[model samples]
Target: MSAAGVDSAPFVRLTAVTKRFGRAPPALDGIEGIVRGGRITGLVGPDGAGKTTLIRLMTGLMLPDEGTVEVLGYDTRRQPAAIQAAVGYMPQRFGLYEDLSVQENLELYADLRGLAKGERDRTFAELLQFTDLARFTTRLAGKLSGGMKQKLGLACALLRKPQLLLLDEPGVGVDPISRRDLWRMVENLTEEGIGVIWSTAYLEEAEACDHVFLLNQGRLLFSGPPREMTARVEDRVFRLSGTDGRRRHRLARLLEREGVVDGVIQGEAIRLVMKPGVTPPLGEDESVASSRTAATPPRFEDAFIDMLGGGPGGRSKLAETQRSFAVGDGKPVIEARGLTKRFGDFTAAADITFDIPRGEIFGLLGPNGAGKSTTFKMLCGLLKPSAGEGRVAGFDLRRDAPEARNRLGYMAQKFSLYGDLSVIQNLNFFAGVYGLSGITKRERIELMKEIFDFRPILDLSAKDLPLGLKQRLALACAVLHEPEVLFLDEPTSGVDPITRREFWTHINGLVEKGVTVLVTTHFMDEAEYCDRISLIYRGRSIALGSPDEMKSRIVREDLPDPTMEDAFIALIGASEAEEAA
Candidate 1:
């Protein structure tokens, strides 16, 4: 009754759980944890870290190979049906009838739960108001945006008002605004004394949870409050500023130094996570000497990475001679002149114009349903624009589409790798498609394997690899031929911070070698890495400038130190108001 003899009783508890599949390591290696009512419990880990396996066990979808899982004071193995009835579960891929309307889906779920007419009506109205889907009740669930569908799934889960709720990776593939709204609703539910178990790949979400259980490689590394975990690295973090060279140069220097655990560009400074009790090193380089290093507070991410034993060599340790860009009188590598795309009665992109200089990192950012993707597709020659012209690498996109594609590398938002093929097989196939033959192809494949440190997983199938490794494989294939320009659409979406930093480090290395990059992302912090960014909303480029420039434009006196995210929200709000008028 009391979590298999624990002193303090928990609403749900796992005692010495262990699960394994095939010849691989155990999915849950003797894990012990608890979930209490009236608080949000966060299960934070990278993809394939047993977060989903544990969630399934807790919800009675799977039984533990060893030990016991108790929920609501009942053993899950003995009484799975009782657990299912008392618990509301929303998996990563929620099941909602795509052809049915929003109201119809809610009605179906309510009837399945055997809710009375009065109860169903009251619950339906409440869900509609809370999820902000009241206006779209008649709309088909399939037609809803990704965020709306997630909300609809959540509403369906809450229809019965179960005592315990389980949400598995709800923020995956959703935009920032939708993530914020979903968290707000979860918090409100916790206030009503309903227990919640939330699993996520995003570490930042852990700060909002009352308790956190960190899993990695099927082991429970830490389990406690967020502050307690973050405090493990207190006074070890440092901020270095006033560097003289480019961001990559500074980052490279920091990574090269000893005692520097992790370093990343943070606005006008570089935040370094150092080893315990290690002092900042004094460098002979002028850029390093001029920098002012001071101790700073540690973030949750800092401790998490430190606990996991440092990142993949902060900024790519294996250095090579980088290709340089000639900045003389030459046309920009990418250009869009009055580009417009229309779908029947709807305009996806309208008169969008922008230019990306050679070797520059250009960012296209906006909320879901915005025109960023449309604009990107047109520039990549995937779609023929309804009006105007575009060019890439001095080749006209429309007439010279073949030549333009040869000079470019593109990674789509979706997982584009061959699933059935092994890592090396995918690499070979992509290399051949890019026209690499004989020694050149073999040499390039070897180089990519070294660059991404993908040698160990070469024999593994692409579908079985972890999400981070899959991303690396995709990027490696995209740039195998060393194209002049690279296009990334939501490249870092739904990835952990450490993996993102590693991916950006590779991108920075390419940028240093004169590779022009155009990227689209939802993470506001990533915008700081770009030379300039264009924010698209309602099929128009409303703002285009550096991250600092965009932040400076926010003149609201009530707000203090407005971040890039705040500026983006303000700009989009203004654009929406104008359209309504």
Candidate 2:
């Protein structure tokens, strides 16, 4: 059914919906909106901005403390079970049994939905074919990649033929290619008269929605088309290119200026957002005037930042403590030559080769389970490679694992801090692990505390800290020993935009101080921060270049200025097609 053929009716209605949790602020306060069938509605907001709570209310999993929530014309409080049976809710991870095969998972969901015996076979066939998982039937769910898991979760949700589908951040950790594919799958179903409520932390992805509900701090900030959001920052966005090696340092200093509202690294340049009434500060210097500074179209993210009172500006305080490096030594800081990792007869990473010089940020990008992690583990000395060499700080990882490890710091995706310990205790533990002691330990810990602004939360438990602080503590711990190389694996997965900018400011700062960074991230925006990128697939490097060069590889007359995301999708799609050929 096309949008023209489908009826445009409100499937879910919120009238003065107010929900409170404990004694803190209301999770959702006085939100009134209508979700129309036959269209995709986006719920855009930062983490803990009441998106999940609002979706839960519509599912009837929880009722609002005040006001009313009506789904499919049924009152949520009085007819909770009725709403649950008619709607499909796929939370972040979904309830896929990892040990079960893909086929068995589908069958289990069919059973849970209580489909008739005659209908089970038809539904199973449709979903397997629809999600393109027919060939991987016998494969265990745990063995599937991150993108495959999301597709399986969507298939499970659709098993009951739901009238309305509620997806909570389906693209959380999936790569750009996978994210685009999953989005197309969902958009196809909306044509069949199903309503969708997609909540996401990635504001850029939400721009395609038919309608969007912008939520922030338990309030409805905006309820309209995404274009309306972009309109808020019209003519305010600008991009300026600069000489090599000066972009990051300039970004730091420019962020503190009164004329600049928010600025981030854009390849070899900075994307600057000027404060209203302030001109682009190109400077009066002849060199600065000669450089190009052009106004670009405003995006959903720019509008979002403007709505939330602008982005994180200026240089990071954390960058001020470290001395800038001269990079006199021309040797690469981190090296992986023909690295291969095998478990039994299965190879995880095969013949991977890359190198990162001092003060460079090298990124390894790949689909989930696509050898990126395997290569990282080998380079970081967590796993011994079956062949080839992994070197850091001029030491062979296999022969001198301890020595190589000592010169590097790692921050895992989950932060990996001790939940039971307080902020100060975690800092102390990390300091000791890196061989700091006596006055050295105290001084480093004190520096971390002062730079990270942890004084208020020193006595607080690690688990209780917010997402931004958790990231800060993790980064602080990683750099406590001042390692020459840093390993950041998905450092800002589900964090909001402001926190991400702040984190990158510090990272760019560290890179200037001669810290070689080997990072892996699913966020393409973050990938732009890398000085160079190696995109791997099926245990092999498929594309390697600077961000601009990568994007230019797929450019044609029809598509002149392709984005990094367009480049990623095109490259992966071309590779897959080639493999099939």
The per-prediction CA RMSD against the true structure, in angstroms, equals 3.2, 1.8
**Candidate 1 Cα deviation (angstroms), residue 83:** 0.6
Task: Give one digit per residue, the lDDT tens place, for model 2 in 418-509.
Answer: 98899999999999899999998998899999888899899999998877788889999999998889999999998888889888988988
Clashing pairs in 1: none
**Ten residues in a row with the worst lDDT in model 1?**
1-10
Please provide TM-scores, in order, for all candidate models, with all chains considered together.
Answer: 0.93, 0.96
Q: Candidate 1: where are CA atoms >4 Å away?
A: 1-9, 116-118, 315-330, 555-559, 577-581
Residue 243, candidate 2: Cα error in Å is 4.2
- Local distance difference test, per candidate? 0.86, 0.87
User: Which pairs clash in model 2?
Assistant: 255-314
